[model samples]
Target: MTMMTLQDDLTTAAAKGNTADVESLLRRGAAVNGVNRFGRTAVQVMMMGSWPVAQALLQHGADPNVADRSTRTTPLHDAARTGFVDMVRLLVAAQADPQARDNQSRLPVDLARENGHAEVVAFLETLK
Candidate 1:
């Protein structure tokens, strides 16, 4: 398959929480940070759940800070909003910016707080 197809497939796999497929695509040289037409990277989509898939992507060099073009929301934003504490931690370890502001100029901590993710809030506060 073409490199573009691999990338697009990787994005789809991530969205569906298919960790094995993600690993396969990566092994075959898919661009780890590849985004779709909307600039939605695999890392960002994987943030919805399936830490295993997210971890595989991250381990394979997916960028945790690549934001969506429309929302300017990074994987960190999604992780924080969803109260995925472990995902947030993993993203941070991958060098995601906790203070990154989206199109709405809101930080990850703000999202965590608004979403009632107290642990995420407390963790992000330390980064500021």
Candidate 2:
């Protein structure tokens, strides 16, 4: 398979929350930070509730702060937006930039608050 295929596969596996596939792809030379055809990295599209997937990607050097092409939203933004506090914690542990602003100039905490995720919002606020 081509390098691009590996990247796409990795992203797909991560999005599906398939930790084994994600780890296999990484070991097979898939770039941990590689973007797919959608211009999103594995971490960017990973299932927010899947901590094992997130952990595997992060351990393989996936960039926790890598922003989306159009919105500039990081993995932290997605996690916070979805009210997945565990995913947010995983991203933060990987050094994700909580202050990263999206195209709307909104922080991850802002998304959490907007989405009615009080716990996520509170958790992010404490990092400041």
Where is model 2 more than 4 Å wrong at Cα? 1-4
lDDT, candidate 2, residue 98? 90
Candidate 1: which pairs clash? none
Best by lDDT: 2
Candidates' RMSD to native = 2.6, 2.1
- Estimate the TM-score for candidate 2: 0.94
List where candidate 1 sits over 4 angstroms from the true fold: 1-4
lDDT of 1 at 115: 95
Model 1 residue 18 lDDT score: 89
Candidate with top TM-score is 2
Q: Residue 115 CA error for candidate 2 (Å)?
A: 1.0
